[model samples]
Target: MLSETNKKILSLAVPAAFSNLFDMIQVIVDMIMLGRVSPVAIAAAGISMQFLGLLYAFMASFSVGNSAVVSRFVGAKELDEASKTTFTSSVIAFLISIPFTIFGVFFSKYVFIFMGSSEEVVKAGETYLSIISLTFPVIFIEFALYSSLNASGDTKTPLKIVVVANVINTVLAYTLIFGKFGFPALGIKGAAIATAISYYISFVLYLYVFLTKKSIVSFYPLFVKDYAKRVLGIGIPAGVERVITYFSFLLFVKMIAEYGTYTLAGYQVGLRIEGLAFMPGFGFTIAAMTLVGQSIGAKNYEEAQKLGWQTAKIASVFMGFMGVLMFLFPQYFAMIFTNDEKVIQEAILYLKVVGLTQVPLAIGFVLSGALRGAGSTKLTLLINTASLWFFRIIPAYVLSKMFGNVLYIYYAMFVETFLKAGILYYMFKKGYWKRQVKWKT
Candidate 1:
């Protein structure tokens, strides 16, 4: 019933979706374990995760650029070029992550205090953030390899590795946090240690895959300046976009924090739960990126456009269904992460409010990936930065000040998603990306 093109999309998308889901599970597990500790624990860990997220956002440039370049090479049947790009990208990723890792380890306490947390939250977050920071280089290296494999049309290997790593994280967190099986109870420190261990293991597994020649790309370390330049040239805009976007998001988080500790914790819980909807959207986005990049490399421009739209159509269906479930069962989902009645109530409101935005969010996700895959990262950078500040952040800030209720802030988020989705659809249809990129490879 499905064409080969459609089947190819699913082949890449399904495994990638599961991988993203498992990745989110790692964070959700942290929240769940910490939630049992205290509401303050939840708030503290949440802030630490957000800071880590900022670092990931910056690293996204290398991943996105690497995917675009490497996918094009694979499509063109240039395996040697693809392998060189991967090694250079990985090296760049490791180098850039070092500074952030050092900053996070040394200045984590100051970061929490600047986040306007209570004294208990600041102390707890300091411990968690400092421990987690040790894994920044490991995470970047793992992600570089992960993205390379996906671009080369091998998503299943990464998926398998992530599932096993997630299991390890869960079991370790349970034993360490509760002092089971000869482990001493270390509270937040224990959770952070579990997280760091799992990341290192995942990196090692990825390395093994490359070294064994099981992967499409090999693990030989190379520093190709031309390749690195090309990758960064394509990625810098996306990276800059991420820096601005995350900064804006942190401001949004600060606004939510103004309400109180319980509200911040509830917001974090809702975000972790809503991450369920994001996994499929992200997966399909990868599918679009890979398919479109390959199609363009073969110079089949129409097929590239068709694949992009097809990916968006499928992603919207899954995301829309998730929205319905979130709208109907917000309370049940909220309860999984926290027992505090106040936190539960706030999370319920957030889920109910955000549930309606899923479909548009899906379109935004897949289309942007398509554009970036075609080396239109600059376009995405402009659109995302402008829409975030104009439609989301500024309005949310004004609403937070004008009304005592947080409901207006949630409404602003919905409006931004709707507008951004529409703009992305228009850009994709106009075929600007095809004209904008002149492939250097």
Candidate 2:
């Protein structure tokens, strides 16, 4: 028998999970379509996508902060404060995306080159990077809107919108990438343009919802500097954490690239396939964050703790099942993304190694989300930075050098996830996060 709290968490988690799954599918569609062109194309798109992930990490800080603050307000029955938070977070997201968008368009080629990619790969990635960069502001806005809705316990709206957006993205990607339906084949660049167009569509949908006041949190014209400070105070640490985390992952990718283009492509495909397992964790993280924020806002610290644990338990079960599938049928999942034998082999290896760590990964994901919701962003920052560098990055570099095999790299990731999961559990149990939240009313 499931508790009512567990049921409510799933009500939010399941839809959010499906929505994230669709987002992953959108990216997979791009990879699958591009994989037919060449492994180099796959590798190029993968590298560019990683850079985009880095940018999104920075943008996610605002969204995460918005969710925490807005959910708390809603919990306290303060709809006005929630609305103000929504508008301010959206503006901040837009403002922060501008410089990154400009740099991505103008100088992204140097980034690929510096990552040690071949000239051909760098050339293939440049246009893709430039086109996608143009959509950063739209992406930021859409993210903020989604965060606000999720905070207000309206996960279904974002889920519905994402489903529609991904359908459009898939159709556009296919038509443009293959020059289908009387369109000229644009290859990787076409895929980028399709993604950019889809983002604009999503932005419009989000704007419509806001303007119509269909969301629980409505937008207003006023800007409060103190509210901005409060949001950013929580967001900056979260953003810095993501920036460092992604930067480290970029270095990790650079190391993988040294193995060969086929290996990098294989790793990329493996990751996309692994999203099947990880998306559930991400979904539960959202649920945990929102529920915890609301609970804390209501001044029910015990309930917030319980919500975090329940979310983690459910996420672990789901992720563990995914791990079983990954372990049993790694090749099947790997093959869906690429036809190359070498790429498939590398991807299979990655799936098998990382699959074993899925449960612990789920724990890390949920607990971290709960802490963030409780406004313990700085704690997460410290733990993630220390553990990531010490347990994953430094060890990965050392092991890769000593063994000169990609297998050691995957092992390092497995070890890091387990250790970090334990550390997060300890922190959650210590209950320091309860003190972090302060009611504004």
Candidate 3:
């Protein structure tokens, strides 16, 4: 009864969804352990993670570009070219990560201070940030490899790697955070070490897969300037999009920080819980990106368009169901992370408010991914940048100043999601991507 396209989408999406689910579970476990330590601990770790997101923002450049380009190559049956692009992209990503590592090691404390964190939080976050920063190159290289693998429809490999990595991270985090198994209790620092170790191990596993030729894209280690240009051409806009978006997110977090430690902790808990709902959407987004790229590569633009809409429709259903749960019983979710009454109340407000936006968020995720797959990164960049700033951040800023209520700020976010989804749907329907993409290589 299932169409071949539908089955292909699920084959990619189902594995990816489980991968994201495990990833979220790992983060939730970390936050749960940190919460047991104190609300300040949760705030410290949460802020540190946001600051670290800058590294991922930078990684987005090559990772996304690699996906857009390499997926097409795979679709066209050009395995050698895909391998070269993957290798070139990986090298560039590693080089880019070095400076970030140095900066994070030396200047992490300054980031906390700049974010207006309290002394306790600043002290707690400093070591964690520094330790996590050390893994930047590992993170960058592995993400590049993983993106290539997924583009080639090998999501299952990454899922396996993540499952093992999460197990290692969770066990190490629990042991080191609590001084179990004769390990000294390092608290936040322990969490950082666990994360760094898992990243390094995962990178090694990914590299092994490529070197052994177990993956669709092998580890060729060749640098092709033309290929690099092709990749970066598509990636730069995506990278800029991520950089600006994350910077805005940090600014958004800074605004939330003004509400005090308890509120920030609550927000962090709610974010982790909300991330659970994002798993299905994230999986389908990857599906759209890969399938669309492949379809476009085969010069089947109609199939590409159809695939995008199908993926978005499926993602909306899953995310909308999750929205219902969050809207109805946020406190049940909040309790899994922490027991503090004030924190629970703040988290409850956040979950309930954000619950309304899940379907729209799902729409935006998959369609933008589809656009990126069609080599329309610039279009996505424009849509995301304009929407984030004009609809979300600026409005949230004014509302926060006027009412001084985080609820109004959240409502601004809720409104922006719908607007962004509408714009993305319009662009996807307009079929601009069919005209925009002209394949080279």
Each candidate's number of clashing pairs is 0, 0, 0
Using all chains and alpha carbons, the TM-scores for the candidates as numbered come to 0.91, 0.91, 0.92
Error of 2 at 269 (Å): 4.1
Model 3: how far residue 171 lies from native, Å: 2.6
Clashing pairs in 1: none
lDDT of 3 by residue, 1-441 (tens): 988978899999989999989877787789989988888788888887777677778777898999998999998899999999999999989888888889888988888898789998888888888898899888888989989999999999999999999999999999998899999988888899999999899999998999999987897778999989888999989999999998898788878989899889899889988998888888999999999998887788998999999999989999999999999999999998889999999999999988989999999999999999998999999999999999999999999999998888899999999999999999999999889998966
Highest lDDT model number: 3
Q: How does model 3 score by TM-score? A: 0.92
Model 2 regions lying over 4 Å from their true place: 36-44, 116-124, 180-185, 256-266, 335-348, 402-405
lDDT, each prediction: 0.89, 0.89, 0.91
lDDT of 2 by residue, 1-441 (tens): 988988999999999999988887787778889999888778888888778788778976798889999889988888888999899998898999999888988988987897789989999888888898899888888888899899888889888888888989989998998899999999988899888998899899999998899987889767777778878888889999999888787788889989999889899888877878888898999999999999887888999999999999999999999998888899999887778999999999999988898999999999999999998999999998999999998999999999999999999999999999999999999998876777678
Worst lDDT 10-window in candidate 3 = 47-56
Give the 10-residue window scoring lowest on summed lDDT in candidate 1: 215-224
Candidates by lDDT, descending order? 3, 1, 2
